[model samples]
Target: MMPQTTEMADKLDVLDRGSDGEQRSQPDVTAQSSKVSPLDVLKTDLPAGLVVFLVALPLCLGIALASGAPLFSGLIAGIVGGLVIPLISRAPLSVSGPAAGLAAIVFTGISALGSFSVFALAVVIAGVMQLVLGVLRAGGIAHYFPSSVIKGMLTAIGVLLILKQLPHAIGLDVEEFGAMSFQVGKENTFSLIARALEVIQPGAAIISVGCVALLVFWDKVPALKKLTWLPGPLVAVLGGTLANELFQRNYQTVALQSEHLVRLPSTDGAGGLLGALHLPDWSAITRADVWTLAVTLAVVASLETLLNLEAVDRIDPWRRKSPPNREMLAQGMGNLTSGLLGGLPITSVVVRSSAGVNAGGRTKAVALFHGLFLMLAVLFMAPLLTRIPLACLAAILLTTGYKLAKPKLFSDMYRLGWSQFTPFMVTVLAIVLTDLLKGVAIGLAVGLAFVLRESMSRVYEVSREGQLVTIRLNKEAFFFSRGKLVSLFEELPRDTHVILDAEAAPFVDHDVADAIRDFQSSAGLRNIQVEVRGLKLAPVAPG
Candidate 1:
């Protein structure tokens, strides 16, 4: 292998520049690492924690409800992700908790496994799988995903968020979680809008609209955006909460109660938070259903984590990168701890991760602060949290979703070239029509097919100057290209000076080498003078 040149290293430094808006020399998000002061990390982490907490609070409950798990289980995951994972994680800024990606798996596990205890067994096993994957250094697979496809996936999720949460924001409830197609009661965005107009829950709708408007205005208004310390989402949620509180106080509008409230699990006291921790049931581990669900959870959770990690790194204000394998280990530990304590499955979340970065969080310490805040909220302000309206939570998610599927997202992907655009577009459509995993599967299949097509068409261009014939093979020189080499040799004119240059080729398969040697022997009869070049430049023989 060639040693990295000084120029290359300088180029890399330029790519890693913080807040400099320079293009990175390498596109791989996980390949680089950097350093920071402990105090700076702590300072940034505190506000990041607050922002993530605000974003994560509603998501935890919604994902738990979607997954058919007890609502408290979601909080358990959030707490574990915030408090436990940060302590163990190699990546400082990332926040972990109940993942939206695992909702389908959780739904299946509870329905088939028959009990939450059985499902807990699966969560534990999935943790083990993730830990092993980290050990195997399989996180490199994330690098293979085309950037356009990732952008598409994130954007599509954003679009879906708007479609899914719009109903909730308008004070219309979907009996199921984020209704994919919108069939049951008041299904679809159109119907929800009509319902919002007809049976107007004036208080909830008014507050939600106000929250969205405030969020939009805050970002667009020059002076408000300058208030960097104040996070827009936090302000939106708080404003909505205050709106509901004031409306109820004067009897100007109907009080928003259980139907619209953010329900925190009722505990007798401070002890209730501790008592909520669930332990794994050993007997449940023996069931085959447990193993199946565990595998499912691990696969889904890992995918979501990998995807979020990529997004977080992309949006990092510092342009700092995370080691994927190390991230896997941290998440694995988080899941293992959360499951043992009867929490939901956890993964890195984009919204919370973004909140951390935007809030000036420089390290994992901010995540810890967020967890502490959640614990305090549960212990001291549980009743206050109840007064917060679901619409407000809906508003937060709507903003998240909108950002994910923003129009500029599509435009950016389209400009990146077909290799990225096709798979990304496919991923977006597939996820919209199906679920996350299946959609990714379809995208991967398309991506793989493109790879294979490029592989098979690997070409070697040859130029004839007088009696000399010079050949330059593409990067890929392998057994698969043997037939092409043979055809090329057969077509070449005899009694010519020939040079085979494999220097540009990183690899030359054994079969290809054999084919080359055979071609040389055969050419001797035709009086063709043949020479191989570039092989000596490498430390060892080309593979």
Candidate 2:
């Protein structure tokens, strides 16, 4: 064979082998082996960790508050996510933590289960379920979701963050921090906003507005963008805290109270840390409710983690693929640890992962360092953290939400046509109306409906010229199309020459092939001459 033809054949052979699920051997010098030294990685990782720490700290507190769990629980989850998960996960840039998406589930589970400790037990059980799922190689299930539905999910999450955070931003302290569901506390998203409008605290509103403006300015201005070392959210938090302190000292009327700021349990030493940790109530293991919550948590957390891993991988500068099963295993271990230590259930979070990527995190060290920072902060700077206003954190999340559901994303989706746009919109609406899992389920149903409709409508193409008729079966002529096929066969004109062609079809189902053969046998009665081609005959039963 010619050299070019030989190369083409080799490439085809590789592709064929890949299709059979065979693992390809790598070169002696793998990508990771040739990477930078640990010292160089540390240089990049430390700064990135600081940025992620600044981003993660408030989210941890906020999500915990939203879940109706102890605020310290979120911190514990963050610590485990950062300190433990990275040690096992293959995704270098992905960051795991207490997820906002699970706040609603945690909140409901706690209420139903009767205690945080009981819910913690559920989380532990959920971790075991995740480990099982990983071992079963179920991580690939995430790939089955349509791209439009996934995008819709991200968009819906963004909208939820903005809507949920608005009350906090405007200084309404009634609702918990990081509530993502439509209904939070006693009020829904809309009612909460309406209530906030009536009872907006001037100091909180001012700080939130200023912080949001600063974040936007920092993001958009080219000169400000050059200062990458200083993350905008960190600046916003520090500046907002100082501004709040100033207001408290001078203008008491506009000053935010302690209730409007973060409240972390102070630790005096190792003894204090140990005392603060609440162990799970292992007695709840036998309860059906506990097992239900465990299954739900495992499914949701696994889905979210896989999706976040995919998103993070896409944005990684090195363009590395994360091992999804390994990620599941790591997350399982982290959640198990968190549950034992009184933390909220953890998952790979998009917000923190994206922040890590944008902050130039080169390795897992960044995540490890961020966890260390969380540990150190809780140990020494708990009082200082309490001074940071919730409004400032709300503002930061508002920006994060905007990035996820930007107007441009909607426009781009619309341009992709109705098939893509319809499911996308449905998912968004469902999520807005209900919750994440329900929304995704609704979207998947709609996407499948579209697929079925397409399949049914395009079963075959028919054309006629005088007495000559051609019926060309589609690439997928399956049993599902039997009804249409039967109708088309019956409608054939008398005394016409009918050609039933399946030569181009990759798969002609047994039922379809049988139908074609029946039509061929019956054509004589209708005075039609039928020529069936390329369909493999099914085996006949022995008389």
Which lDDT tens digits does candidate 1 get at residues 1-543? 234467545555554522212333552222222444454445445655776776677678778887888887888889889888888776667888887767877887789978787677778889989999899988777788766666666766766777776666766664333344323333544566576557667777787788888888886786875454566767887898888888888856555667777767778676876676666777877788788778888877888888878867776654567889988888888888888888889998766775566445666777888888777777777877778787876776777677566666566667766777788899888877676667777888887777666775765788889889998876878677888889988888877999999888888887788888877777988889878886532233444
Off by over 4 Å in 1: 1-44, 175-200, 221-223, 226-228, 250-257, 273-278, 358-360, 455-458, 462-472, 478-504, 510-543
Residue 62 error, candidate 2, Å: 3.7
TM-score of 1: 0.79
* lDDT values for all models: 0.73, 0.81
Q: TM-score winner among the candidates?
A: 2
Candidate 1 local distance difference test against the native: 0.73
Q: Model 2 off-target regions past 4 Å?
A: 1-47, 108-115, 282-292, 314-319, 358-362, 514-525, 539-543
For candidate 1, give the lDDT of residue 455. Answer: 78
In terms of lDDT, which candidate is strongest?
2
Which lDDT tens digits does candidate 2 get at residues 112-187?
9999999999999999889888899888877888878877887787788788888888898777675566766467
Candidate 2 has a TM-score of 0.85
Error of 2 at 130 (Å): 1.9
